[model samples]
Target: MQFMKFRKIFSVALAGALLLTSTSLFGEGNVADAAVISSIPNTTRTLKSYDNSFLSVTGYASLSGGVKDRSSYVGTSYYRTVKTSREFLQALLDAKSGSVKVIEIAANLNLGWKELNLSSTEIQKYNFVAKYEDPTNGYTNPTLQANGVSKINVSDTNGLTIFSTSGSTIKHAELKLQSSANDIVIRNLNFDEMWQWDDVGNHKEVGWTFIKVNGANNVWIDHCKFAIGADGMVDIENGSSGLTFSWCKFGLEANTNPASDSAIYKSITYMEQKYTSNQLASTSLYYKMRKAGATPNQIMAYSAYHSKCHLVGSGDKDYVNYVDSNGKDYKDGNQRLRITLAYNQYSNVGQRVPMIRQGVGHMINCYIDDTTHMNLENSVSSFKANSTSLARGMNARNGASIAADTCVYNGVTEPIVGTELQGQDTSNMDPQWANLFKNAYNRNLIVNSQVTNANGTYTGSSWDNNGVNLFTKGFVWYNKSTLNKWAWSSSIVGAANMSKTKPPTTPFTFQYNYTEKLPYSYNAVPLNDVVQTVKQYSGASKVTLSAKDWLKTVYSTSSTPTTGSSVNVGSYYRIKNVNSGKYLSAPTDASGTKLVQTADKTQATSLWRIVAGDTGYVNLVAQVGSASKVIDIPGASTDNGVQLQIWGGTAGADWQQFKLKDNGDGTFGILTMISGGTQGLDVNAKSTAEGASVIQYNYAASANQKWVFEFVK
Candidate 1:
């Protein structure tokens, strides 16, 4: 599925922290001198070859100085095909600096998951308060594990393009590029099975990244699908620059959260039972805060879903300090972390769509939809400050400069952050939000909620500066830098209902005293076409397979519909397991009944009708079950081995909607749409007994996952 290349690379004129506690989330405060680079370039260097910039490498990756990389160009080499995990790793090892080596992933590669390991016996220490790692070494040394995490760690390896052939899936792993590595291209491959639960309430587990740019430079990542990782989906850190992410789909469904049996829940239960109140309080803030006001259930509820998404810089004081092999200092006078995110789609994300500390970004035509948040739907337009999604959409911190206007935002709690003033009145009636909005948010199309609008509609409220500065400037910064960037958990608990026409109070400022803009040019499509464009082209073409809907078939004649049925919806089919030849059955016609695999085909419970659900998915409604009863995971869990069940009153939840993936072999895999489109139903132990359990597991393509949906008359 080689994409014919459509337009992307929009204006994200670019651009954290470590705090661990039950209530004290990882946050940034009004402290510390802001990070500073030797120089801030007025404009980015322009690219010479700009033909068919659509889906092509553009933005900072196509240029230099505050971008990801220079380009993926360096001459061409015959592509070598790789099918297995080992072969995939070997091909990357074979890469050199002169000629670009193209590798076509031909198979669904499953790299297993891995926890952190040093590779060496040296004990690594972490300074939690200072937020620094590898303090003794002063050098960044990372071990590249081959399984479940295909790390890109080739030192000095410049030219490489890894593309998918419309069928391959690289999951349970990540493709990380270290600082010593540079000049790489990753396109059209789906990256999933990467997100996992951390030590509950204490988001201190800082290692999950689908594509971690740990100080890597000049990298072009396009057409790739990324799921939320524990730490971040794509983290650019350690002074890496020249990066571009175009035509990509990031985040997950609005309600995707950890199962009741997941690590977060288990951890909360363990901590609650293991430590007493005063004893636990004496040890950590996580417990102390929970003791203060938050209940264990409250902590688990708050800590369930992933909050952060794409991160440009790792932390506030995290500066670039690399000396290239050519003796060129990469730190003394380094460019800001420059990134471009155009024609990308962000759905149900919490925050940090390329949130940077000291970088410049240009985000062109993009679609950001976070309105589906459970909290938002219940709030009816009022935003709760303690909710993890309090801060949604793009943010700027630590003197970071960002420009994002040519985009559509829907139901974002705080559409833009790090650019606004914190602690305004609860009424959200204050005219002075941030000094940067009159220029950025003023141009964005924003709405509070498509489903939950209690206050009037609003958009330009969250756009503000992200850092606290010592140097003074305007109403706040003019000769008086920021007091501090707002925390992720905002304190303002109300609708940010300021209209676009509303003017800030007297002596207000809109322009920033210190900012960086890009020189690269890419025309944006009409705003009307943004949602359709990205949905049609983003992600690996073969995985979600949504690209085909826009690329060729059913052109513009039909728009993507908001799917679902209150009870019964579409066609009926009898689902039979490919392995055991057993039928997926539900008996007693009751809710909360665990679905089982049975040998009986005449049972009415075996029949299920498919109803449209959550766009590009379908709900399997049990024929004789309770009213509106559909197939669902007990806790809407993402973990393996969670038994499938029939539940009533789900209201076409995304968790109940399965992506019926055609196996190309007269069979299908009923995949969970929220598990990044990988985890699916499996016949437990491949059992052939009278009644065997059907549970969710990572997609293995084995007969257990393969099922034949027999059409019923």
Candidate 2:
């Protein structure tokens, strides 16, 4: 009996819940526990439920405000009221409003401004100081006497500031909040329309951030649609504690005026300028964008106050950066320059914006999908991380240090888990933009979820690419086998030695593909049919066998064997010494059956010849388990009548070879030895019914010989 070699990587899922001993370094204090609130009316009214869940501000019911009574109180629970953005702003600034019991913001909060004017050019034209009717009001109105606009401040006097602070537009909203000392909960409200452009075909430049919570603890933004907007659909402020944005849709709007040209150029310039000023703390911000609307363009800016501004970019070319020499080097004015912008796109064309900046950015267990053109910057320009940075997207850009412009794209691919850059679409083009801004932001997940491609090729890089373009992680999928590079983590080797062109063996998260254990099984065939069948479906063609030896040619790494072959453990072999009429032997089975004895030899003349026949009978009756690759001949075999032959000749000519050696004990050992060994299978007897005469023949050259042993006592 001869043994064939087989190799198997440890399955990640097979490893049961790994007990990660709680450590001070990787503590669980940061892990938030969330309570899903229902969409029904007023479920989050009680302050107790909001306690410890972060700060939740719900505005589901109508809020009544009388002229004399400057305070706006939440109306009855049953009343489904519409709260416009103006009203929300009023309520937030209402003097009589007590300590916010979690910014309980809710629906119908519209932003209705028709031809409004302003005085302050610095803040925004629509900037109006909320003044309490009474002199003792807690909030004080900012001075509005810019030039000659002293009396032109009230809504009636100025008609209302419809479009104020430029850059991104925000409109239409609702919210329900429950708050406690350390947490907040916001449920069942829409964050729709950032800026309402005039034309139906234009894309808006404004981005609306529903709730900008600053200096809070344990925040969760989930099940929300941040659809259609020019600016960030949702922006979490700096110094916020434990925030999560999950199950949300973020994309561009099909119908809206393109974002103002000046605003975009200025935003980028502003970010670069700010970085130039702060060399110690600020780094480049990564902005990722997907192609959408008539023109797929994106813009981003990194804030100045916050530190750790390490930036990178993601998404398509449309979402990347455009370095221009327009605005004054205000950032570098009279100061030594410290930073630069090393920006790049996936394909050299496309627009990208910094939807997310780094303030405490973290995307854990979150998904980024279906973005035609995206710019994923690594700096803290737009999207900030409040928790973990485990995201999914088309690509991503990362930087090394502050003032660093060196950014690279973390293109989304498969089996090679990336640094969260991923997509759900396999098509070459971007997914269609939606009528609403929120839908566009979330289009990726929706499109990816609809991908039923049998091959699981549901991403842009998956098609028209080979293994080099496709990346496969043992567990976490990110690398593109086509590029043959690992964009994020180092492959097995630490990040320092990680290959920019190879997939990492280590996973980015616990849920990587390696977490699952695969069950082993084989295709059954008669002893007379083993050899022929294996020939048809074995080795590099149908097995994980190294094609280098089988094909007798030097092939690319991709052409090498993978884990797509089946196992055939029952194939048997008959080993006989050429000069000495003996066979290999080991401990006998319960039935006292063993290989014919053979004296070890040291020359090629002592070769063995083999023939195909049914050996299952010998295996069953003899009590010797019908295992694969368990024998070793004293000498090698020659094309001639090699006397010493341990052949597993099945139906066809000689094929299977027993290379895998069995453990001295009864158990079969691992085949496919990495160091040095042949990968193939040996034949087996049909059963005692066949008088142990059924033995097959073959060479060791396929995954079929790699048998997954299941010991039966």
Candidate 3:
């Protein structure tokens, strides 16, 4: 069998020509005008119609006072207004008071105004005098602090909506959602400088995560901005589920110091001390010392136990083997956290854009512009012992899974680094865990450019224009067949070398046909292009309520099927006939028992697993007890009416492998590798009778030829 070849890169002139063609087709218009058009609602329906229509809805009342001197004991009547971070905490704590609450935050308001407005000396004095306190781990009553506030808790609250109207900024505060905080929405707010300062002056020693979703469910954070945190900007852990972060931005503010610097120093010093003293200490004690204003030498007494700090998705707790309320361990079911990150932008952020652990993540249409700060020099020093850099645009670690599509990365220059889309299982503890990374799917576009800001800020017009134009003109969304073709044809190369490789020119063009005029101008661009439309609204300023609503409409009504052409390689499934509700079965593990469709039953004969084969084909293995059997063509025949049967699986048998052609309507047509897509597996004579013979025949768009693989344990 011939494997697919590597893709070639386009020349500079060819790439420019293709970009120009796309621009002309999509109507070249000013981005500022597009931004204005995005703000206006496309439909005339009242704004209230969308109140609960989306998972994200904005319109919270602001509090009267500033950050300082704000009351934490506000009544339910004042719960709607959140003028200070303390009040915001109280409002969240009071979310359970009402059946359904909508707490609207004031737009263009800053929660940390008092601290931010203070002079440098005043800020230092405040840090010096204040006692550092750590929030309790699980559910507890709100504790009053020296600042006259309580530790914020959102445990056991449901049907809560906390949103910023427009252009609101929440600075210097951490939002913690733990102990089963469910059905929450936070959107359109900027979380800036949410870090705690050590007694001496270091702001990176303490845990000041912007949003921590621990043991929560059904939370949506949309169209928000996260910048400059002491730890992870957002850390979702402890079996959280149904979380989505859409059209958000994750990056550093201009000219700001990173928290990773302190984390690295602490890690290195701790490691040196551990090696010299031969004493092992709990990592938590080191954090305590740091918070208690330990000297450098005092901190050096501990080993570097916590190195991968100060990044997105850091400190992710294990979700496996979680015991539910009934004392049942969900080691294999309902224990992994699931997240969808769509149409977001990541720039100048450290590694873990994000690093998933014991969960699954789907990242679609994201833009990663730069990774200079995530290089080896800035990464955890211990990580450099084995690899050049610890940076990963998207990574799945310790049996986690990730699927990334239509992502674009530019201005990354690390050669000996981790995989841009990576999966690592170092211990090889479980056989299933060894193949977890094979579940990862990545289809990305890499561009070579030196786009940089001298001040390290991403807010100027130049940055905006570059980001907007790249989304509008330079990206392409591939169909299932095309994506599979590309995946098979191209080799998985590092991001540093991706710009040098070229792909087929046809797949680089947009999939939709242009007819109507662009939304903002008279120039016509393609309509019904889901990826392009979503990309147009990916930035901090462009992702308005109207844009988000428009995106929701497009996403809901689009005909795109979630599954691609390639079958889930490592997943076990039941192959059922679309015409007849029966599953394809092998009566025995013998070599020549004609395959037949049988009634659904809880037997191994009815279950199959798709395994990756040579040259981009898949082998369907029968889950018969202790039998290494696969669906095979008898006598290695390539005839049209040859029957398929279960036989002993060979290492590289072409006749046993099949290519699954996605019909784009939730069905797959199975074609044998021997026939080379000329023939497909069909129910004999199109009969719906039980025990009918399965045969290979000329390909046709018939229901008998289509199959759906229902996931089964």
Candidate 4:
């Protein structure tokens, strides 16, 4: 019904798949299709079977990641693996309308670094703006003023999908999607460290959010583990449309590792170097350390880090941007601010379980549990400072349409902000927010009854904030309710010109909805099963997958490499680079001998024997002067041009071991798992001349990285 107002942005506003025609979202199952096939032994949550139906995202964000959801080969034009923060940001920069990419995060990349190290060529070639937050300005030198925003600007594109492996986290940063970002999917990652040293800790002036989707469309965020951020978890503003959040855990734990080398502690140290003394003393850190008597290392360990979960629209008329079939674009209600929340867990959070100002929202089987804290939050900066009130829930104003079906709440004060803000100038009881409570059902309103009971009745007295007022009293939870009445109705406050802060030149009434068919169809798991399902399969590592295995699912092929792709154990061979047509050779089978690409394959130094090594990998032993030494990435350096050498190794360490990845053709790309991502062997500069050097580089599937194995055991 939400999409009925739309004039079809692309096609006929697909009912089956949101924006694309695909298989059903849930695939008619109760359990999740979340398992991945894994062979690495003794892994946690080791998966044995995988259809991955749950991978099909439902609701407004179904169009994200284009038509496909699985990761592809690194050699493909659209797929890459990133480890560092710069690489992660560069992956976003390299994508746009014509260029689409899928980025797989391989490590916990910290974005709080004060500067980006730009090479000399980029320094001399361009006149760059010094704002480090925005890397589009060439060389970025981060200043504290710019909000340190590294954007995933997928402009005018069908989509860009960013996901992560089991061990990766996008820490100490904020991900903002703005300016015509379209059809994006962010999945299977951990996020944290937006929490900084707020001056007063009122959280009014600190403007750091975990993920801000501004004017972006068809975005789906799935299976992400969001930690305690500085401000809100997600703020979808300025008319972003068709957003979905599925199986995400917001605020599981605070980043409390306060060791000197910890990310949060390092950020604190970095902030100390840039600010004034008074500014430093006014920090939330100072409040915790000086006032609450906490050490620098132990101060953050007491943070219950989440507050202000989601804010759908910044203002009433920050309308969505939409496109018609004839290519006409409209920035209005018909195409803006529609969101879906399915199977999300909000733990130890404060409020705004999505306070939508306008547009439509559908919440199915969501879990908003705020009963406990993840850390030992002090009274000075606890999310609930008053110690008398409970956390507020969903609120809607400005005639927006919202409905919560089969949702659950734990220790939530107001299921829909009715009792919490009754006397608090809610625009004539905020009649528009009535359904947010009535439709969702305030289980807390029932006396001595379970919130999970479908047939529960509410005869209990309404909630009041004990004695603590909105202006403090250091509000804390675990207080007795003070107020005795409940109020909510269709007090839909509407204005001819809905804009509150910024008014349009010509005033127009905002299109408000009481109910709107969802833009897509989905089968949500029953309300009772939500807790179990989410607990079993939400956030990173729960849906265990490696980039390699996900690619196998996409290609639908065997796990093994192709013909002659295997470097047989105890067998000798002369390996030749495809691009250079040169043999992999060294002068002597001794330590420190650099491997070279020689033209003559018949030379004795060119011969290599394969020894058993790590699983799915082999140690290439060079045979020369009646001695054997294993091929090694010297010092296991991950630099781009690190030369390979033959060294002695009783066991092939990850550095000494090389794995063969089949290119499907007769050739294979030799890679190492130790370096992370696709670090592979390559011939320098594609040189065909004899004695050309061989080095390790990021795998781009270039001819230099592909090798042909000529067996001669």
Query: What's the lDDT for all of these models?
Result: 0.52, 0.23, 0.46, 0.54
- Quote model 4's TM-score: 0.53
Worst 10 residues of 4 by lDDT: 37-46
In order of appearance, the predictions have TM-scores of 0.49, 0.26, 0.40, 0.53
Model 1 residue 196 distance off true place after TM-score fit, in angstroms: 2.7
Predictions: Cα RMSD each: 16.4, 30.1, 29.8, 16.0
Q: List the candidate 3 regions with Cα displacement exceeding 4 Å.
A: 1-79, 85-87, 107-151, 195-204, 253-319, 324-335, 371-391, 413-536, 539-713
Cα error, candidate 1, residue 570 (Å): 23
Ranking 2 against 3 by TM-score, winner? 3
Q: What is the lDDT ranking, best to worst?
A: 4, 1, 3, 2
What's the C-alpha lDDT at position 366 in model 2?
19
Top of the candidates by lDDT: 4
Q: Residue 143, candidate 2: how far off, in angstroms? A: 30
Most TM-score-accurate candidate: 4
Distance from true location, Cα of 168 in model 2, Å: 22
Candidate 2 accuracy as lDDT: 0.23
Sort all candidates by TM-score, best to worst: 4, 1, 3, 2
List runs of model 4 lying over 4 Å from the truth: 1-52, 63-75, 119-152, 254-301, 317-335, 374-390, 418-516, 526-528, 546-713
lDDT of 3 by residue, 1-713 (tens): 21111001112112321321112111244432121121111211121111112222211111111011112222335337566644554565566665335565654433333333445674453331122254333101111111211123467676566665333675445566764566666766776544322222223455656677775666777767776454567877666666667767776322223233333343435444543474533333334343345444433222111112222232322313345557654322222466767557665553566666545555544665554443422343432322232323554443343444334444332211222222322343344333333333333211111122221211111112422333223222222222212221121223122221132222111111113211111111111122233333433333223212221211221122222222344445778788887789888876677788988657888878665565336778776653467788988888888879987766677788887765645677888888887788899888789898889998895898998876552
Looking at model 3, report the run of 10 residues with the lowest lDDT sum: 61-70
